[model samples]
Target: MRLEEIARRLGLEAAVAGKGMAAEVTGGYCSDLLSDVMANAKEGYVWVTIQTHQNVVAVAGLTSVAGVVIAGGHRPDEETIARAGHEGVTILLTPMSGFEVAGRVHALLSQTS
Candidate 1:
């Protein structure tokens, strides 16, 4: 499923839609620790985290993630959102926990795949 489709299905709020990021999501990964996410998340995967910090944007860039999903009803700081925008990484916000978002995204991708 496409990122936009997944966002709609999960009721995720789009915080930043940088360049072609919305067209890049092929999978999903859920992790709260920045280091674990940076190390384990695959490129083109929607990264689900609750950090909501500027470093999350940097890590998203490093991992080449399709998007960053701020879970648990958290909003990223202004700097984080701006950086994500500049880096062409879509930023998403959701009221669900990281695990819930991950599960929903995974289910969607599985069904579509």
Candidate 2:
């Protein structure tokens, strides 16, 4: 599914709609640790995390994730938002926990597959 589709499906709010990101969601991955996310996230996949740091932008860039979803209603700080915008990474916020978001994403993917 597209990034916009995934966001719509999960009722996620867009925090930073980076250039080209809303048009690029293809898959999803949920991780809390930056290292694990950087290592496991695939290009075009939406990354779900509780982390609200600037490093999330770097990891998203390195992994080429389609977007970053900040779960548990958390929002990124100004610096993180700016970096994400600069890096072309879409940042989203959802009220659900990481596990809930991941499960929803998986269910959506399963339905589509």
User: What local distance difference test score does each model get?
Assistant: 0.83, 0.84
lDDT value for model 1: 0.83
Deviation in angstroms for 36 in model 1? Answer: 1.3
Alpha-carbon RMSD, each predicted model: 1.4, 1.6
Per-residue lDDT for 41-103 in model 2, tens only?
898888989899899999988888888899998888899999887877889899899899988
Could you tell me the lDDT of residue 100 within candidate 2? 92
Give the Cα error of residue 34 in candidate 1, in Å.
Answer: 1.7
**CA displacement after TM-score superposition, residue 111 of candidate 1 (Å):** 0.4
Q: C-alpha displacement of 71 in model 2, angstroms? A: 0.2
Q: Which stretch of 10 consecutive residues in model 2 shows the poorest summed lDDT?
A: 18-27
Off by over 4 Å in 2: 19-26
